[model samples]
Target: MNLKTIFFTIAFLASFHIFSQNTYVFLGSYNRDKEAESIQVYQLDSEGRLTKVASTTNVINPSYLTISPNGKYIYACTDTKTPNAGSISSFEFNPKNKTLTFLNKQTSGGENPVYISVHKNGKWLVNANYTDGSVAVHPLLENGIIDSMAQNIHYSDRSIHKERQTRSHVHSAVFSPEFDVLFLPDLGADKIRSYAFDENQKKPLTETQIPFTKTDLEAGPRHFTFHPNQKFGYCIEEMSGSISVYTYKNGILQQIQRINTHADEIKEGFESSDIHISPDGKFLYASNRGKENNIAVFSISENGFLKNIGYQSTFGDHPRIFAIDESGKFLVATNVISGNVIVFKRNPITGLLQKTGTEVKMENVSCVQIKKYY
Candidate 1:
């Protein structure tokens, strides 16, 4: 090759390597006593190591977080148990400096706001309140600031579990792949409620005639996620420690299978927390907290059924949430009780995880999110 051509090729490869070397990670913590900051930002190297970049401390009980579709803003649920005291806060994210600037906060319309999801159109923010059993929708301004609650719906129903299901407890609010429907998983009601979402309307969500799908009595649906194909949905049951698979079509969900997240030998105290499917849709993963501090791995069949592959120990306590990187190359688990984050290298071919021996200590970390920063 000519000397000039070889030089240009070397420069192009160097730029690509630099672009692929790091990703931005954001962590939310449940810090009531001010032991640690509420939100933290870090740089995650390709080898799965974390280096602190920036942190903010004003927000309280920032247990969960979701990023905007444009990657310019982050929304977090400020989980407070006092009546009508919960709030959702928005922050502007700067990829250049890895810092977050507080934008604004608004009432969540209920207590103990736990989960937040942004609409694909970047005009709506939906949050689920766990303590007061309600769903709140907020309007997002063009500048990424969140306005007051546009709509709030309360659920009064209760399930069979007397103590835990005394009232409705909405654990998560997730949007469908097409962003035409919203699913709210109620941990205290044993049901997954669906709502039609229309971004064109002033009030974007309305109850459909077929509003919800019921799980087994006292099953306690905690979180819901959709398959990449948009034809299937899965719910992680917090109380039963099982996953319920369903066929989703035009905002309707039909249950297809229910499988245990724990081994048969380990029966009690299995509290499954979060669920995610691989980027390629070849595998599924769920986190178990109570007695079995591990992540269950399942292979996805062509028909959308899940087969149990194996489990990997988290090597920590109370893995409240875990996230797979956008590249599908690494998995990180944030252990709430242990106050440590564990990194696992994922095998793309086998769909299994191996510990990378990279741990970062962050007190009361409850959620971890990874995204590519360009």
Candidate 2:
């Protein structure tokens, strides 16, 4: 090829590569019926548009998903709702083809496994069962198949609420940034239960010196996340519609502040669901589902306190889960009742969100996880 032709060809190839970059989005959902897809995949392009790529109905009610640290495997908390019917399913992600292949599954040792957390080393897989009020641990094989349940711990504690707190309901399993501690937010018990963990141990989880940190009565602590700085932790309360802020260290937590998670003048009956801090650690967001279907945004201080910024309407009902991509440029939220997925452009500096992307419709979309496939 001539030099002029070579330059033009190279420019065209570069443009194609940029246009084809992948932002693989994994969405999990409740089964509306037998034919519903429980887990689906999509590509999020540069313009905040989400285009369907592939989907799978291999598992039922894969409500929550977690990608392995290496990003080679994906695990889902499948079979939610029914008693004794929950399981954790694993899949191998073929990034080259942008597809997922079923690997293996193991009983989560309880029903309604709503959350899964894989160890940073990728050996231990932990999950929390909401219906059965239990926590289970499973070992991961080299090929990403989940082994049998290695340990199971059942919690019988009850909180003040007669209906919602009749028994412990573990809402999420989150590991400390250091991976040395595991925190389980038990919604029904109104506490953040924690454990000291070492993946090499036969039973990796052991209770910490402070087994749990009590929240307000009937607060219903749900999803938990640590600030990127690793100095603070936060959890969204489903019942109280609040975010409890804590200073964390040595697998223990000290409550520093508690702030409302709903929009101004909008209170009561807000069923809060997910909590996530921005990659820059400057912003924190929590989703409310019931009455006020919105996201409460906050600005973070150096001392780990939060100031309410504003709220963004999710424009859908029951936004059960939301995820911020690693770039901190796009935020995706999924609604279960409306069965719609919406992507928002994020302002990294102000921590506000704007609805500018494409909207997608999925059945019972309950969870969203975003990862770049480059």
lDDT of 2 by residue, 195-236 (tens): 999888999888766899899999999999999988899988
**All candidates' lDDT scores?**
0.90, 0.88
Candidate 1 has its poorest 10 consecutive residues by lDDT at: 14-23
Error of 2 at 132 (Å): 1.6
Taking every candidate in turn, the Cα RMSD to the unseen true structure, in Å, is 2.3, 3.3
| Model 2 lowest lDDT segment of ten | 14-23
Model 1: CA > 4 A from native: 1-16, 19-22, 82-84
User: Per-candidate TM vs. native?
Assistant: 0.95, 0.94
lDDT score, residue 314, model 2? 97
| Best candidate according to TM-score | 1
Superposed on all Cα atoms, model 1 deviates from the true structure by an RMSD in Å of 2.3
**Candidate 2: global Cα-lDDT?**
0.88
